[model samples]
Target: MQELKIERLVKRYPGRDQVIAVNHVDVEVQAGEMLVLLGPSGCGKTTLLRCVAGLEDAQEGRILLEGQPVFDASSGMNQPTHLRDIGMVFQNYSLWPHMTVQANVEYPLRARGAKADDRARRAAEVLEVVQCAHLSDRIPAMLSGGQQQRIALARALAPRPKVMLLDEPLSNLDALLRVELRAHLRAIHRELGFTGIYVTHDQIEAFNLGTRVAVMNAGRIEQLGSASQVYERPATEYVARFLGIRNSLAIDPQGGWHAGPTPLAGDLGRLDQHQGPMQLYVRPPSVSVLPADAPAPGPGQIVLSGARVKDVLYAGGEIDFVVELGQATLYATMRVGGAAPRASDPVRIQFASSDALLYRNGQLIDG
Candidate 1:
């Protein structure tokens, strides 16, 4: 069943420098699924989430929660945020500093007029679910950042809301804590099976938590798909770049590909059917730099000969090689412990043609 539906959503700021926050966006989140809105700042992802929670009044759209209309612009019906039955976990954790963890977790149920005993029981249950039951007696200030965020999650889950909206809830934590809490959040979601919409600019978080990811840009969703689908085969240049597939080369009408003035060699058998100018995108890992004197590549592989190594940087387990092909630069990485190539070394860049992502007019060409 569709737990949440957002249709034709349009939100705009009225001023001399008016901005369209959400532009005719449509999304349907299935029950028990975590739909992640993945985008950089100012991409309208947070605005869309706020609209669903009834925190923002969109100029045009209809928001439905489990088949019930929460906001319908055409009919002029706008359900207030409190009545929308959404549990939101904010970036700051949003715990009352003076309240005990137990009180913080039970506050929502208490506000809904649940009996004291019922609120206590529900809070305890969710606290256990979030692995924060032992911290019930401590105030927010007494707990660690991770513990506080877990308590915040417990609080949100205590009321058994129809939809849980998380707006970058882990952003405030340190990198190590973020990873630890991300695992906890995924485990909790699996155990509880609550419908969720998570907003984050972190690609790793989106890939780790979302059942489906919507990559947004400039007030619109550029691509929506599974983590592998979005990561391996991004639908547009924006999504490709955002996902770290940074090598974008221009493919001419004659099927020749180049980054700057230097032409790169690739199998053009697949490009015979594609017309006009095309863009080819490939991930840095997909590219490999070899000695210029290396043997010729086999079929279905792309090879750029006479490329000069501009620089090499050690990045943890991998070595990043900045290769200059004419006036354009392309990045390639290889595992460390190998004979490191120095700058100005003549190298040949290579990658498989099958890994190339070809797009025309900003849309991916069907393979």
Candidate 2:
């Protein structure tokens, strides 16, 4: 069943010049599925999420939560946020510093007029679930950042909302805590099976948590698919770049490849049917940088010579080689080994054709 649905959503901001924050966006989230809105800042992801929560009134759109109309611009019906019955977790934790953990978790239930006994029971249950029952008497100021966020999550879960909206809930935590909390969040979602929409600019978090990821760009969804699908085969150049496919080269009709004015050396075999100018994209890990005198790669690999290693960055167990090929620069990631080339050293770059993606007019070409 569809838990949440959005249709023809358009949100515009008034200023010196009109800015469209969300433009004709449509999305349907299935029951018990966690849909992640992944994008950079100012891409309208947060605005869209707020619209769903009834925190922002969209100029044009119809939003349905559990088959009930929460917002319909055409009918002039905009339900208030409290009446929408949603649980939201913000990046700032948003916990009441003066309230104890138990009180903080029971506030929503109290607002809804839940009985005192019911509220107490539910608060205790959720705090236990979030593994913070021991800290129930402690105030937000007495807890660590992670503990406070967990209490915030417990509060959100106490209401048993129809849908949960998480706006970068883990963004403010340290890296290790973020990872730990991500695992906890995923585990909780699986155990409870609640429908949720999570927003984040971090790809790693999106990939780790989302059942389906929607990549947003410039107030539009550029691509939407499974994490593997979006990561392995991005639909557009923007999605490709966002997913870290940094080595992009242009290909001409005669099968010639070039990075700007610098011509490249590669056959890019089996390009007879792809017409006109096309772009080839490969991720840093897929490209191999070796000494200029290294032997040619095996079959099905495209090799480019006359490249120079301009810089090398040590990334603990891995090395990032910045190679200059004529006017173009490409990055290659490899494990730290004895054969690692230093800066200003001559090098060659090679990658498998199967690992490369071909695009024409910003769309992937089916081989």
Q: Give the TM-score of candidate 2.
A: 0.97
Candidate 1 lDDT over 170-273, as tens digits, reads: 99999999999999999999988999999999999999999999999999989999998988888988898898887878767553655556666767666556
Which consecutive 10 residues in model 2 have the weakest lDDT in total?
A: 254-263
Per-model C-alpha lDDT, please?
0.89, 0.90
User: What's the lDDT of the predicted structure labeled candidate 2?
Assistant: 0.90
Task: State the lDDT at 298 in candidate 2.
Answer: 84
Q: Where does model 1 exceed 4 Å of error? A: 253-260
**Clash totals, every prediction:** 0, 0
Model 2 segments more than 4 A misplaced: 255-267
In candidate 1 the C-alpha lDDT for residue 219 amounts to 94
Which candidate number would show the highest lDDT if scored against the true structure? 2
lDDT of 2 at 169: 95
| Candidate 1: C-alpha lDDT | 0.89
